[model samples]
Target: MFCYQCEQTMRSDVQDGCYTDKGVCGKTAETSDLQDILIYQVKGIAQYAQLARGLGVVDVAVDDFIQFAIFTTLTNVNFTSARFVSLVQQAAEVRNSIKDKYLAAALLKGVEAEVPMGPAQFDPAADMDNILKQESVAIVNKDHDIIGEDANGLKMLILYGMKGVCAYSHHARMLGYRQDDIDAEIERILTYLTSNPTDIEDLLNQALSAGHLNLKVMDLLDRANNETFGNQEPTQVRVTPVAGKCLLVSGHDLHDMHQILEQTKDMGINVYTHGEMLPAHAYPGLKKYPHLAGNYGGAWQDQQREFAEFPGPIVLTSNCIIEPAKNYRQRIFTTGPVGWPGVRHIEGGNYKPLIQAAKALPGFKADEEEKTITTGFGHHTVLGVADKVIDAVKSGAIKHFFMIGGCDGAKPGRNYYTELAEKTPDDTIMMTLGCNKFRFNKEEFGDIGGIPRLLDMGQCNDAFSAIKVATELANAFECGVNDLPLSLMVSWFEQKATAVLLALLAAGVKGIHLGPSLPPYLTSNLLAVLVERFDIRVNGTAEADLEKALGHAVA
Candidate 1:
């Protein structure tokens, strides 16, 4: 098995991926191979789905399956090989159904339907062993020798970015949001990928197109969240534990969080948000629940210690779930595309089993003193104070805007984000989103007159909020977004962050500082293209990068 889709992927002079028996994320080779097979099948589905759309026949179910199947392949999302096997089989069935539809629609139109070869006609092996042997079709870097490293890297950029798009689209769909144009773009890109095209310019354009597609998906998700849960408002969330039976809900699914809150309401369960779910407390509709407790832990990387130490059951609602330790494995539950081999999965929005486990365990022995952090500085809330922010900027009370946040990870260089945020001048406002904010959100940055110096914009997907805020600020200043005093210091860990990065680039936002390290899939040639065209910079030392952004050394 081979995988290099996340920041934690193996890298060295000789090897750049986890091709061994197990990955750094604890994913077994068998699981990795199965995920590859599933992805290949999804491409087959897209091949036909793209054609069927051209014939004016669209299947919402096919679109949903494509989104879900790709989301499952994201880093740390699913590690259950059995689940992938089923998904691979289901993908073939979906592909066939779509293939037939495309043919019939062309017949009705009395036009010849051009059926593509390769993945469009792929037939899954009958058994898991044979299926695993289909690595020739499933490998991510297949035909790199023919396409060369640069083209392969660009392909990976588009594929990984598409994964992020699907993940966000899946979340929006759960919230009852659907956009056919977005679906068509998804099919178009995936179908394009099947041909293994090597044209450098076309590949680069398609990669940027993925970023543009993600921008739309992010906007849809933003609307779905705001309309369904009410716009986010600035609220201080308790970080300390409360005394009672409790349940910790991690991951980024607000819909699942709401369901858990509803099912366990008034049942003596204190529901606490963890990781990306921390933003749940800022939504008026969700926070209205009396027992909707506060945040419990930092980010996803620290979950092993946090989940083990906690006395109640833990529920993972989305991606970035590592393998569960034995002690808490029985008490932990997976939902909505997240899985581990033995962990119980809660299906159909049911929480009875998870609630039962929470009741059986001992919750916090006693209430801890109140500790808080502010969140919910989404676009709506930030724009609500636009006049005050604009005035402060014009008056020279706020100098520069540093958007320093993205997916956080366990890597050593991650401390760069913390150091940069900590060292920002008092005159600069820092806006952050995703788990990377955990690196400094607990610290005090004071305020710029009436505006909080630090603005916590929701989850990773809330990059939409950050982008919206930047555009509004640019409009206020009567200049381009890049012309505004905003520097995006992105710390990426997974595909969702990749998608966000692409969105930023697609919007012509330049000079982004991206690190802990560049993706292994990025060949030096592709990196050079980004650097020359977009002025993208690999992250340097916190002091040096910060000085470059501020144009002066911090005191």
Candidate 2:
């Protein structure tokens, strides 16, 4: 029952430990066990996808299965025992269907050729460890497929990142951002999970390949976001809380965000973005509303403190919901798959519950006059300043770029992010998104050419912005992304960060320094694959890492 896959782990050290005692995140022990099992089974699906890719068999259903597995793992989505069990069973069925049909065909072909491909051995109810071990092997080098703890951690990072990507990709798909090649890779990863290879070296290679495939997925999503939604532009928003009937919107659903923005436009209900929703101000469409306000607080982990004083109802569009506090009690509305036992859920873009709750509450009174925060400097906005950026680079005005954002949590060690931001060289620019940005967003980092040293690039979902900026920087510099003087120091707290990591790998951005901690769910085989291909490393002290990043040895 151990789990610390997010930034919310209670442990002080970043050794990937978890405090499963008394249920962190309000997940019961049984539910935690079920989620572990579900993750294990999905690894099997990842094996199957990898194997199918090796066989040149591409299928769409397999892609859907991968997305569903990730979505099911998202925060605050499926806490009920029954729903968790149903998801595990559903994953098993998908694995069985893919394996049974494929195995039968291979065996029959072998028998007809007097070659007997090997005895058909496929079972869904087989030992769970065996499935996970096999899945681990599929992502590693086939010639050397044994996995260790580090490798496992790396693989989990990549897979979970892909899961996060799939969630956003799904949303973009809703907005018409579809790419068959990305879908195929998802299928390939899932199928490969079913393979039983034990070669350590080979398994490691497969892990790198997974990262490569993720690059394609990220690119597809980037195009979807920019082409469909328009590039980001600089904008500012107010942070004052709305009184009376207020609706707090959280999560990464741009569609739901837009819907709420529209529904509450004239309803006297003020809408404030929470957690991942803070980046909504970067969008041209959503920012048009005069009623849309600034971010409410930090990541989902801070809800207990941030939601305490709110006077109105809150609507969660996705994951990362903390156990409700008394102030927000009876006023929380869950949307999409996000659920809490007593909270109301609004399904399928439904706003009736949100509207009703908004009306039922006393309605919003302005907590204070609008206080503005600068945001909306995503890739597009950066590129728009392309000429100025290029000039600054040539003049040595901007020496280094640091992408210092990811999930934020309640853990004590997360303060390192804030410390690092505070210590960043004044000449360097820090780009951030996600709740992690809360650490430094309020700091007094002066601007370079009117752009704050702490630049808000949108949400974790908008890691797309980070990727786009990196790629564009490489293009502008006429060198590979690795050649740019940019460093990535991120803190991951959920599966969405998983997808962003994969995207980074896919783009061949190597030697990333990650931390606050590593995920507790990964196995060694996966980490080895990452080390071999991407040279990924965990973060150390902020001063140490910052010095290292700046090419300065200990003084």
Candidate 3:
């Protein structure tokens, strides 16, 4: 198996990938192989889905399934091999169903159907072993020498970027939001992947175009979250457990969290948020639940220790799920796109088994001293204080702005983010989003007059919020977003963040500082294009980057 879609991908001057029995993200060979087959078939489905769209036969279900299937294949989302195998077969069936629909529609129009000769016309193997045999020609680098490393790397940029697009779109779709333009664009990009293009420069341009497409996906997701939950408001959430039967909901699926909260209401159980679900407390619709307790744990990486110590059933609703540990193995649950080998998966929006597991376990014998952290300072919350923010900057009360947001990882240099946030001057304001805030969210940064120095935007999908905020700020100042007194110090670990970065570049938001490590899939030449075109740079020490952000020249 070959994969290099995350911050932890194996990299060096000479090589940039993970081609082994296991990936750094803990994905096993069997699961990775099945994921590739699923992607291949998804592309085959798209080959027909795109044509179906052109023949006046639009299938919204097919489009949603395409996004959902690609979302399942993202890093650290689904690790169950059997599930992927099933998805592969389902993909082909969906493709055939759509193909038939398109042809029938064409015939009814008194016109003949034109069938494509590639994936649209091919038959996939029914079993796993023969499916593995197809990998020789389907792998990302199958034509590496012919296209060279640079072109191959650019292709990966588009492929992985779209995976992120699919991930965000899937979350939005779950909440009943989707645009045909965005859906068709995602299908179009996947169709491009099936052809195996080789022009280095052309592929690079397409990658940037993907950045443009990702902007729309993020915008759709932002609207879905805000319109569904009401805008986030500044709220203090308790971290210490309340005395009661406890159920911990992790990952970032707010829809699942709401459903669980609804089912478990008045059941003598206390629902607590973990990891990315911490932001749920800020949303008015979600926060209205009386039983929805406070947050627990730090970030996704700390789950091994935190989950083992928790005294109740833990439900992972989305990505960033690790293999379940023995301490709480039976009590652990998976839902939505997240999966594990032996853990129970709750489907059809049922919470009985999970609620029963919570009742069976001994939860929090005694309440710890209550600890509170401030969150919910998303676009709505921040912009509500726009007058104060503008005055602070106009009066030189707030000297500069820093956007230290993106996905989090367990990599070594991750501590750089913690240090960078901690060392920011009292005069600077920090706008943070995603799980990366786990690094420094616990700390008290006080406030700049009335505004908190550190503002917690929602999750990774809130990149849309960040972009809106920056654009508005720019307009307020009569300048470009890049001209604002703001700096982007982004920490990315996976494809969703990759898609967000592309959105930033597409919007002409420049001088981005990206790290804890560069994507291994980017060849040096491709990196040069990003550096020159976007003014992108790998992160240096927190001390050095901090100085740059503050306008202090360092020798």
Best by lDDT: 1
lDDT of 1 by residue, 169-204 (tens): 999999999999999999999989998899999999
Worst 10 residues of 1 by lDDT: 135-144
Sort every candidate by lDDT, greatest first. 1, 3, 2
Q: Mind sharing the TM-score for model 3?
A: 0.97
Determine which window of 10 residues in candidate 2 has minimal summed lDDT. 112-121
lDDT of candidate model 2 versus the reference: 0.68
Q: Which lDDT values do the candidates have, in the order given?
A: 0.92, 0.68, 0.86
- Cα RMSD of predicted structure 2: 5.4
Give stretches of model 3 more than 4 Å off.
Answer: 12-14, 553-555
lDDT of 3 by residue, 393-467 (tens): 999999999999988878798888898898888889999988889888989999999899999887886788889
Q: RMSD, each candidate, Å?
A: 0.8, 5.4, 1.6
Model 1 stretches with alpha carbons more than 4 Å out:
none
lDDT of 2 by residue, 1-555 (tens): 555556554555544445454356777655556566676666666665555544555556766766755676665565655565667667778876766555655565563211112111323334444433343222222222355455455455545655666677676665666677777666555445444444556555565566676556556666666665566777777776655566788877777888888877887666788877877777777878877766777677778777766656787767877778766768888776566767777777768777877778775454677676778887778888878877877888988899887888777678888888888887898998677887778667897776567789877767767887888878888999888888898887777776677667766789888777666554455556567778887888989998888898434
